[model samples]
Target: MRLSLTPLGVLLGAIFSTAVLAQDSDTTTITDYDVISAPALSSDRIKSEVLIEVTTVGTRLIAVGAHGNIIWKEGDDWQQAEVDTSVLLTSIAFADEQNGWATGHHGVIIKSEDGGKSWKRQLDGFELMTLEEGYFENRIEKLNEQLESTDDEDVIGELEWQLEEAQFQVSNIEAAREEGPSKPFLDLYVKDSQTVLAIGAYGTFLKTEDGGESWQVISGRLENPGGYHLNTIFGRGDDLYIVGEAGLAFASYDGGENWETLDSPYRGSLFGGHLDAEGRVWVYGLRGNAFVSDDKGQNFTTVDTGTRVNLSAGTNTNKGTQLIVGHSGTILEIDDQLEVKNRTHPSGSVMTDIIEVAEGEWIMTGRSGLLHWPAKITEEEALATQQGAQ
Candidate 1:
């Protein structure tokens, strides 16, 4: 399969805008060598800020978003924690309650040992290029020796071509090394404290067995010959699924070591996916198109959401319903039988991730910042309003 290996943001920028689209969305990360570990600014309005992802760490909720902001739930409040990078962090995953990792623009990866309280950088684009340089240079040396012994002109030419390509790859790594780490990891799934899977644009698939200490690029394991951009990945039990651009999708039954390209239902870009409790695989994306398949993606049926806005985020909440959030403040709830229910929110920004905090309440973060959707008013709040009216 071909490997495009482009920062996901740049592709979106080309479709949206070359200038402010990436900057505003924090979507693409390029070879930027500046590694700043600045502290996040404290704010009373943090809930209204643009957060990208939220995950549960034990009983606490932790979120990461633009400007290296990491927030963890503190009792009934949310508190911002210290982070080492100002790069836009798009996804966060914890292998355990105390060990987790965050991925973002510039091929940045940070580790946290104390839940989400603090983070330390383990790998960046600079070091990644260094590793690739050594790998390609060694391969070129071996190919040169093989070329010296070959007699056939066709064989000689093939070896020479491979030698030249390997050398070219080494030079490319050196050039990108000088530029910095601009590649962005779009999503992550942590299997354990020692295992992780990260995916991104142009078939960027990586696996780490010993946490982030070492990484092995494994894009060849999937059948994505076009190097389709992989957007989101989720798993339930042993079933794993990855949804991406250009109607691309893949499923794996054994963690993520191997994959099977599943039949797609939508021809447009799919932004996110989730595996619900009922063993149903749900995928959503461009326009208002969404699909659910019970037979492990062999076939999927379209869901009528009554909106055309692109769906960006989705999760099966504690309330046993699948909630999907999208552009123009779009929200759709799916029951066990795939019945649709609509909800309203105040924010119109493109929401990236969402989770339920209460029985009927939800907290979502995205383009405009943060939004708290309350399903029902509390009795105390109603009583206070009634007293004030009198």
Candidate 2:
């Protein structure tokens, strides 16, 4: 499970750092949320909700979310980075100290080479509008072929009716396709400094070499065969893994050239996965299910997380491996032995990302912008204090 980096890996790491150092200040601000239109949903209006994801570049801690919001921690205070475009950002990743990337809906991929001070859109799927048009044309052709093959009068009548419905749907699809792939990027991973992989809804998976300069669609069905939405992508060395709805998991060994589905232990949506230095892989998802794979995901053993709230992201820290900021801002800490040592609530805000800033001090962000220097109390410690008070 623990694979040593080759000399190439070290070289790539250095190059990534160099890219970061070369980043320029291109930060923009979110002056007004009204500028960005809310998503249109049939059942309800798409209210802009704050979604948070955290990562470190050098010593800097960065969290990004809806409306192109980027917050970075400097010593004690957190400052918002000025980002252009009011698109909803879902995830961010750093290639090195200064170079990073943030992705969101509407084919938005913003890159920052000098830390996160500035950002520029690298690639937009607006060009893919043609693909959507072609999709509808193909559907119409298939329906016409079916109608011609039917012979019975009643069957012909039914087929004609279905054909009319198909044409109507296709027309709608054509209109939307003309708008482009508004799917956005849900999760992203930097496989060293040169390679990056991004995944999102509608089985969208994109990969880029030479940093974020160019991108191409990799392996994924237009509509996932399993009908599950992909939530996140994780990479170690040349191996890549993705998890999403319905306990679905997939792996790519040859740098994402080919992918094969893997058996998952549960049947719920997985939010994310992390690989520790010890080579152990941990994945958490819906309804408080946490599974540990000691053998690089060949097998798994379920761990008791003690809560049903969905977990978004987790990482290993000095305090121990922590599952931070999930449903309702729930924070769960697992010690070196993989035991749940403590759980605490720092805020009523739903936590999207958590990072240990210094020793016991941590920083967590969610829908309510950035919170600085949150307190971390172990579960046993909190319990003893409560008992004494009684």
Candidate 3:
């Protein structure tokens, strides 16, 4: 008798392994009570714990998570936005106050030209994989050139064979890329009003020049044969910075054409990064790890974040650099001088994304739903409100 494993079984196995690895990497023990409960939304087919990124378009805020959960916030409440697929949604970005896009597992890409009020499926992952193959072939050509200039005949022959093999491998990759979107995008960044950059698992990086009309894969060192997972991408003018698992940080000067790795102070997953008005770089990651880089990403210094909970996302606000949302809805606010001012716990849920809308008003999204200021309230304000209510 022969036993064969189905694709579903293989996928479950992979997810299980990933969860195990995540637990193994950290010393903290995660219990059933620690897991955030999923809200009773319209759909229950997808996993509720899969939300990774969120962004806003005008008064509307779009949040994506596991199983294609596209939620939009209207006023103080959140409602599920209809989407075609149930693939895990990871990241979303807005080019303006109107046009926006969301990506997720299985090469899933959705676009909303109407400020994320509604989203329509645009492109899938298969096409992106094809573009990546094309981009990789271009790199192989350059590698072949370097091999040809070498005096070592053995090395030249070896590299030539490798190039030929790469061509064949890329052909297979092209087929896979064409297979369509599978996994949700991990993070998305708007380079400008037109260009957008997205990165994900397996070092996947894609770019769109003509808004979301067309897209091209911008390969990175992490997407190479032996690449690492990239968690987030931060854009500043013509420069782009990426941080990921194992404290991986890379900078691209000429857009995403070339990337050089920066020495990270810690060896943990980096979740978020931002450039202040003064051009200072602030990055936060797992275990409450935070770093400040004054000179682009050339050097960094670890700062006291006061908590060891994983920091998911951060942004520059008028009050200072506010890093709200992380493990267990922990909100940490850092001043311009890199001082931790306020640290409050809003909810038991894990906060996946945070964005500053106005001077004091901030919007944060997590596992359950939308987190808005003066509505759901922050930990600090909630306490004050409770005291006044009494």
Of candidates 2 and 1, the better by lDDT:
1
What ordering of candidates by lDDT runs from best to worst? 1, 3, 2
What is the TM-score of each predicted model, taking all chains together? 0.82, 0.71, 0.74
lDDT of 1 by residue, 40-115 (tens): 5567765555678888888999988777788899688788888888777778999888999998766778899999
Ranking by TM-score: 1, 3, 2
Candidate 2 vs candidate 3: which has greater lDDT? 3
The sequence of per-residue lDDT tens digits that candidate 2 reaches over residues 22-109 is 1111122212223133321111111113436777888787777665666676576666676765566778998788778888755577
Point to the candidate with the largest lDDT. 1
Q: Any idea how many clashes model 1 has?
A: 8
In model 2, the runs with Cα more than 4 Å from the true position are 1-51, 128-173, 178-181, 221-223, 376-390
For residue 240, model 1's alpha carbon misses the true position, in angstroms, by 1.3
lDDT of 2 at 317: 78
lDDT of each: 0.74, 0.62, 0.64
Runs with alpha carbons beyond 4 Å of true place in candidate 3: 1-51, 74-80, 137-149, 153-183, 220-225, 357-361, 372-390
lDDT of 3 by residue, 105-185 (tens): 556677777666566766665566666677778878887888868999888887776676567556656544433233336
